[model samples]
Target: MSSGTSNGEHRYVIIGNGIAGTTAAEHIRKADGAASIKLLTNEPHPLYNRIALPPFLKQKIARQKVTIHNEAWHAERNIDLMLEQTAVRVDPLAREVYLASGATLPYDTLLIATGGRANPLPNANGLQNVFNFQTLDDSLAILAQIERSESAVVIGGSYISYELTEAFRSRGLQTTWLMRGPRFLRRVLEAEGGALVDRIAGRHGVQVIHGVEIAEVRGQDGKVSEVVTSDGRVFPCQLLGVGVGITRNVDFLAGSGIETSSAVLTDQCLRSNVPGVFAAGDSAEYYDPYVGHPILMGTWDNATNHGKIVAQNMLGGEVPYDDVPTYSTTLFHNRIMAFGATPESNPDVEAVMWLDEASESYRRLFFQGERMVGGVIIGQRKGFPKLIDLIKQRTPIPVAEREQVLAQSVQ
Candidate 1:
C-alpha cells in the first residue's frame, strides 16, 4: 500500500478491486480532491476485465491489455490501495471495516464491490482435477492443463463453458460439454438459438451431452481420471472443467445489517438498505426496470455502470442507473447478442424467429403485444444498436413490419 498525507479526516473505504471498486475510487477522487480514499482488494494485481480471460487463454490477446490500470496510476492520484488484504467483517452502524489481519479501518462511506465467486463442483471430494474459470490464477492453471492434455470434460453449458470448450478445441484438445438442461444456454437463449450454438460446437469437433448431472469425480493417485454422472455414465478425461456459475461474495456481510437475497439488494441509486452503505457489481441484486424485479447481472457492463452510479450517490450526487440490460458472447464461429428480459423470464411474452439453418443465421424478436421486450441475434452483427434503442425507448413495431425491421440494416 502507498503512503498518503495524514490529513486526519474521515476516509472512504472500498472493498474489492474489480471494475466497480476502481470506478468508485476514480469517481470519488474526481468529485472531491481532498477526500481520502482507500481501496482494499484480495487480489494482488490491479483491476482487469474478467470477461476477457477466455480470449487471453486462447492467446488471442495479452494479459496486460485486459488490465484496467496500473498501480502507479492509483499512487499518482494519492489513493491508497491495499492489495492482497481481505475485509472480513463490516460494522455498518459504526461505519468501520475489520480486516482478516485484525486491522480495523473507519469509513465515512463504504461500498461493497466484493463481486462474486465461481460456483464449485458438487462433491469435490478432494478431487484434484476439478477446476473453475473465474480468476487469472484459474485461467493460468486451465491453460497449463490444456497444453498437457489431449481431452477434457467441461461441466455446465453456459457461456463460460462454451468459451472453455472453444479454448480447449483451439489447442487441439477434444472437448466434451456436460449440461444439466435440455439445451445449451437455455436460460438466456431460445431453443432455436441454442440449437444453432449446439451445431456450431459440433462443427468444432466437440461433444455435447444434455440432461445429465455430474455425480462424483473418480480419481487415481489424487488426480482426476473419470467423472461419473447421475445417469450412471462415466466420462474419461484427464482434465475436468466446471463452470456451473457464480455465487455472490457477500459472506463477509453476514453481520453487516445489509439486506441480501442471493446478493445485496440495492435501489436505483445503488444504495443498500442501510444508509451510508452502497453495493455494486456482481454482488448487487438490483431492480430491473424492464423485468420489474430484483436480478443479479454478472456482466462487465453492469459492474462499470453500477460503480459510476454508486460513486455519484456516495458524493451526494443523484444519478439513477436504469439502462437496458445487455450482454454478448462469441463462440465457435458465431456471435450472440441479447438484451432485456428473455421470453422465459415472462411466460406471457412471445418470440418470433427468423432462421436460415444452412447459413447458421438466426434472428429472434421477443414481444409483449406490439412492444419489443427482448430477443437475440446469432451469426449477425448488424442492427444490434437498433435493437438496444428499441428496447430502451420501449418502441413498438407493427406486426406487418416486424419481420422487415428485423432484417433491415441501420443506415
Candidate 2:
C-alpha cells in the first residue's frame, strides 16, 4: 500500500482488536519497528479468547482466564490500542477512516477485521433473559441469569445454539433445543451423523424438538417467559439462548469501493479489490486454493492464520493462504470434528458415510471427483489426523477402496 516508503514510515490502522487484528499488529511491529500501529475496537476490554467463553459460562474457568491480552500487553508492544471506538465509515479514495465519535484517522494501509455480529432473534430485542452469547459480557450476563433460571430454551442449529444447550444442561437446568431443521448440521452432516448427535444429546437429558420456528416470544415484566412456535406449541423457560448465526460487519464499507458479499471479497493473497485495503478474520471471504473457491470460515485457527498471512501481503509479499482449517468440540463425552470444505461450505462435493451405532461413532468423507476434500466425524476422533492429512494432500482414492478407508481407523 505504501509504495517507495520505508517499512518504518508506514502507518497501519487495524479495525477490530480481535485475534486476527491483534495478531497482524503484533507481526507488523515485529517486521517494521517504527511503523505507527493503531488497533481500534468497540469493546471495552482488550483481546479475549472468544473460544473460552463457553467454559467460562459453564463455570469451568475463572473470568480472568478468558482474557488473552490486556491493555498492558498492547502497551508493552507499543501498539496504540483504541478501546470503545467504533469505525463508522471508510473513504478509500482519501485513505481515511471516520469514527463514530466524528474523528478521522489516516492510514497507509488498513485491515478490516471487524468480524461479524450475532444475529438477533426477531421480536426478542429489548427483553430481558433473552441472550446471544458472542462476547465476554454476554457470557457474564448469561451466567447471572443461570443462577436464577430454572429452565432454558435454545434456538437454531448452529454451534452457538449447541453451546447454550450444553451449558444449560450442564448446569442442571431443564433445557430444550429447538430447530427448524430435522437434524443438527443439516447441511453438513447426513441423517446418520445427525441422529448420532441427537442420541448423545438425549443421553444428556436435552429435549430436542425439530421442525419448528419461533412464532412469538412471550415475556413477563419485560423478561422472557415462554416461546411459542409456528405450530402453536409453547415451551416455557426463564432464559432463551438464540444462535441464528452472524452477519459480517461490513455495512460501513458499503459505499467505499471495497467489494463485499456476505463478507469482504478478497483474492488468495487476502487483498481486497481496493488498493491499500485488506480483510481478515470472519469479515473476509477469501479464495481458498484447496477447495478452488472462496469460502467464509469463522474458526479461531482460520482467523489467526489470516492475520499472520495477510500481514506478509500487506508488507508487499505475495503469500497465498493455504492453511487447512479445522474445528472440534465434545458433545456429552463424544467428540465432533469438521475439517476443510464440507457440504455446508461446498455443496458440489460427493459424500460417503460410515456408521457404527454400537460404538456411537460415525464419519462422512467428502470428495471432489477422486480427491478427498473434507470430512465430518461424530462420536469418534480416532481417524481424525489421517483424514486431515488426506484432505491437505488432496489424495485420490480409488472408488472401490473408499469404504475400506472409512473403516480402517477403528478396525
Reference-based lDDT, residue 204, model 1: 88
| Cα displacement (Å) at residue 331, model 1 | 1.5
TM-score of each: 0.92, 0.97
Candidate 2: which pairs clash?
none
Off by over 4 Å in 1: 1-10, 343-349, 368-370, 396-411
Reference-based lDDT, each prediction: 0.82, 0.89
Model 1: how far residue 221 lies from native, Å: 1.5
True lDDT of residue 401, candidate 2: 71
Scored by TM-score, the top model is 2
Candidate with top lDDT is: 2
- Per-residue C-alpha lDDT of model 2 across residues 1-411, encoded as one tens digit per residue: 463245447888999999999999999888988888999999999999998998888888998999999899999999999999999999989889999999999888999999999999987857899999899889989999999999999999978899999999999999999999988888888888888889989999999988999989999999999999889999999999999899999999999989999999999999999988999999999998778889998889999999999888888889999888888776777878888888877989888898899989888888887778888887758877887888788788887777777888556
Q: How far is candidate 2 from the true structure (C-alpha RMSD, Å)?
A: 1.7
Worst 10 residues of 1 by lDDT: 1-10
